[model samples]
Target: MNENKKTLGELLNASYSAFGYAIGFSCLVNLLMLTAPIYMLQVFDRVLPSQSSDTLVYLTIIAILAIIVYGILDIARAQVLTRVSWWIDNKLSPIALAKSLDHTLLGGSYAAQSLADITTLRQFLSSPSIYAFFDAPWIIIFLIVIFLLSFPLGIIATLGAIVLLSLAILNEKVSRKPLEQANTLHMNNQESISNSIRQAECIQAMGMMSPIVSKWLHNNEAVLAMQCTASDRSGIVLSFSKSIRLILQILILGVGAYYVINGELTSGAMLAASIIMGRALAPAEQAIGAWKQAINALQAYRRLQHYLSQPETRPPEILLPKPQGRIDVNNLLYIPAGAKKPVIQGVQFTLMPGESLGIIGPSGSGKSTLARLLVGIWPPTNGTVRLDGANIYTWNRQDIGNHVGYLPQDTLLFKGSVKENIARMDKIEDAKIISAAQFVGVHDMILHLSHGYDTDTSRYHLSGGQAQRIALARAFYGSPALVVLDEPESNLDQEGLAALELIYKNAQKSGITIIVVSQRPMLMKHCNKVLVMRDGHMERFGLYAEIIR
Candidate 1:
C-alpha cells in the first residue's frame, strides 16, 4: 500500500479508509443509540404529563424515523466491513501465494498455511464479532451521557462499565496462550495428514497404511484435547461476563428508583438510566466473548509479518538475447540439501554449440548433480555456470527456459492431456506436439491411447518406458539451444534405445549443444567427447575414443 515501502499493516490499513467512512457512520449510529431510552423517556414523562394526543403522535413518528435511520446506518457499517474483507482477500492473497511458493521451492510444503492465515484474517474482519471492538470506545460516551442526567446514575454506570472491561481483559489473559497452543497443534496435525496423503503410494507399497492412519489420528486427538481445554476456559469467562452485565443493569435500575423516591430523579430518568447502563455494558460483554477470534487474528497477523520479513524474491530480470548455446562451467562445486559434503567438487567443463558430450560415471559419482547444475536448477557452491557469457541463474528464467531443455532422473507429469504433457502444458499445437513425440518415438504409442492426444494422462497409465519417452518429448517440446538429459534410457528397451540415438543424432546436426549422463557404455558411443566422474571429482575428460583407448 506504500509506494516507497510495504508491510502487512500498510496493506491492511488500505482497507481502513472504508473503516474511516464506517466510523463516521458509527458516530451517527451512536447518536441514534440515544433513540430507545430517549423514546421511552418521552413517552413516560412528556406524553403522560402533557396528555396531548398530537404531541404523542409527533413524538412517536419522530422516534420511528430515528429508529429507521439507525437501522440504515448499522447496515451500512456492516456492509463496509464486508467490503474490507473482500479487499484483503483480493489484495493480499496473491502476495501470500507468491511468498508460499518461495517456501515450497526451498523444500517447504506448499504455502497452504500462509494462505490459511490470510483467510483467517479476512474472516475476522468480516465477522460481526469484530464490530464489538469497533463499538467499545462508545461505552465511555454513553456513561458520560448518563452522568449528565444524574450523578448517582453516572457513578453506577461507570462501575458497571469498569467491571465489564475488567472481565474482558481477564478473558484475554486466560484464553490467549491456550488458544495459541491449540492453533499450533492444529497446524502440526494438518501437516501430518498432508504428509500421509502425499506419500500414500509408498505407504501402500510398504503395507503401512494402518499404522500411518493411527499415527495421524493420535496427532489429531492431541489437537482436539488442546481445543477442548481452551473452549472450557473461554466458556466460563463468557458466562461470567454475561451474568455481570445483566446484574449491573438491574443494580442501576434499583439505584435510579431509589433516587426517584428521594425526589432527586423522575420516573423517566430512572428508566432511561437503566436503559443506558445496559447499552453501555453490551459492547464490553460482546468484546469479552469475541476475544478468541481477536487472538486468532493477532496470531495470523504476526505470522504474515514473519513471512514478509524473509528475503523477498522479485520477478526475473531482462532475458539475454538468444545465444549460440555455449555453456561455460568454471570451478563448479555443489553441496546438496541436508548434506555437509559437496556433491560436485571443483568440476568444470564447456561444450560448444553442435558438440555432444557424454558423462559416464558409476552410481554416486555426481553425474546427475552436474547435469542439474548445467541446467541452472541448483546454484554451484564455488563458481559460475554461464550461458552465453551471462550467469543463467540470474537470467530471466522463463525467457531463458525457451532455450534450455532438462530431463531430471526422476520424470514428472501433471494431470493433463497427452498433448499438453508433450508441450509442457503450453498451447497444444498439433504439429509441434507430434514432432516432439516422434523424435522420442512415442508418437504411435500416444495415438493408441483411448483418446489419443486428448487423453487425460491422470486416468491413463503409462509403463515405465512409455512414461520416460513421453517425458523426453516434453524436454524437447521447444527448440532448445541446450539439452541436458540425466539417465534418459534408464527404463528404455532396445527399440527405445535406438529412438534416443536418433534424437541425439538430430541434436548433433542441428547445432544444438547436448549433455547426456548414462551408466550404459552403449549410450555413450556417439559422443565426440566424454567426462568420467568418481566420488564428486572428475577423473577423466577428453575425446571419447582416446578415453576408451
Candidate 2:
C-alpha cells in the first residue's frame, strides 16, 4: 500500500499555502485597482484647474506606472493559481487513478469518474470564477470610499450590493438541484456508453444498436433538460444582477450631482463615486454570472471527497520469506458488498506444496468466486485463507506477487508488447520472458506473430485462443508457487490442451500448488483431489476417483 495516499480534502488542504500566495497577489492587485479612479479624481480636481502641463504630465506618468504594476501583479496572481492547479493535479491524479483501479476490482461503476472530478477541480482553480471569490472581500473597500465621497451615493451602492447578493443566493437556490441532477445523469450516461462500446460486438450482432442509441438519447435528453433549466435560471439572475449594477452606477452619478449642486460634493468626487460604486458591485455581478461553474466545482469536490474517503489499510510490508504454496481454508464465507446472501459459504480445504485441486461445478456454482478468494482478490466474509501459515488476504501482495499466479475466467491482456505482457509489465530480461512462453507452450505461437515477442496486443489482433494462451503464459511467467487457473482450457484446441497438460506436468515437477476450476476432462484428469460445488456450497471433497464415482 502507498503510505502517501491522501484523501481529497487533505490534498486540497496541503495546497492552502499556494492559495494564500495567490490571495496575497490578489490583494496587491485589488489595492492597485484604486489607481484608475484616483487618477480620474486628480485629473479633474488638480490638473484641469491648475492649467499646468507639468502637473498633467506628472499625474499621467504616475497613473501609468501604477497601472503597469497592477497588470503585473494581476498576471502574477493568475500564475499562482495556475501553478496551484498543476500542483494539486500532480499530487491527486495518481491517487485518483490508483483508487479507480481498486474501485474497479471491487465491482464499482464509473471508476473513471474520480479522475474526471480531479479534472473538473483543476479547471475550476484556473478559471476566473475562482478569482471573483478572491476579490469579493475587497468590495467593502470600494464601498467605504464611496461613502467618503457622498453618504447618499454610498447608501445607493450598498443597496445595489444587497440586491445583487440576493440575486446570487437566488441563483444558487434555484439552480443547485438541476445542476446536480444533470451531472449525475451525465456521468451515468458516460458509463453506459463506455460499457456499450466494450461490448460492441455483441450489441451489433444482436441488432441492439437502435434500441441502445434510443435509450442513450433519452438519457441525454433528460440531462439536457436539467442543464437547460439550470442555465436559464442562472441566466435570468445574471442578467438581473448586471442590470442592477448599471442602474446603481447611474443612480450614484445622479445623487452625486445633487450633492454637488448643494456644494456638499465636488465634481471630481461625483465622477469618482460613480466609478467606485461600479467597482464595489463588480464582484457580485461576476459571481452571479459564474455561479453555475462554482456550483459544479463544489459538487465535483464533494464527489471526489466521497470516492477518496476510503482508508488504505493495507499493512506495511515485512521482510518475510517467500511462500512455498502450502494452503489452508477454514469456514471461508464470502458475500459481495451489497448482497444479502453469501456467494460461497462454510467451505474449507487445504493443500500441501506440489498438490493440485480441481473445482468442478455447474454454471452458478460459484467456482469462479472461489478461485478469486483463493488468490486473495476478494476477502472472505468469514474465516481465512492461509498460504504457508500466513493469511493470504493480509499478506502484502507486493511481497509475494511473484509467488502467486492467477488466470481469471475472463482473460484480459494489456496493450503492450508480448514480452511485456508475459513479464507482467515488469522490466525483466528476454530470457525469462522466453522461458515463461516456452513453459506454457506459447513460445512457437508468439514467434509466429508479426513482431514475434515484441508484438503489441492492441495493434496485432488475436483470436480468443491466442489471447487466453498469452494470459496463461503470464500466469506461469515467474514459475509461481501457487497458480490458480479458472477454465483454462475453455478456448483451447487439442494442441493447446496438450500444452496445458505439459504445463501441469511441469508444475508438478517444480513443486507448484495448482487450483483448476473446470470440468473439462483433459484438465480434470490431472487433478489428484476434486472439490464439487453447488450453489456456493462444497458438496463433495476427496480423491478424484471417489468424487467422479
List clash counts for every candidate, in order.
Answer: 0, 0
Q: After superposition, how far is residue 404 of candidate 1 from its true place, in Å?
A: 2.5
Model 2 segments beyond 4 Å from truth? 1-10, 260-263, 312-319
Superposed Cα RMSD, model 1: 3.3
Best candidate (score: TM-score): 2
Per-residue lDDT over 300-361 for candidate 2, one digit per residue giving the tens place of the 0 to 100 score: 88887766776553445565788889999999999999999989999998999999999998
- Given candidate 2, what's the lDDT at residue 269? 89
lDDT of each: 0.83, 0.87
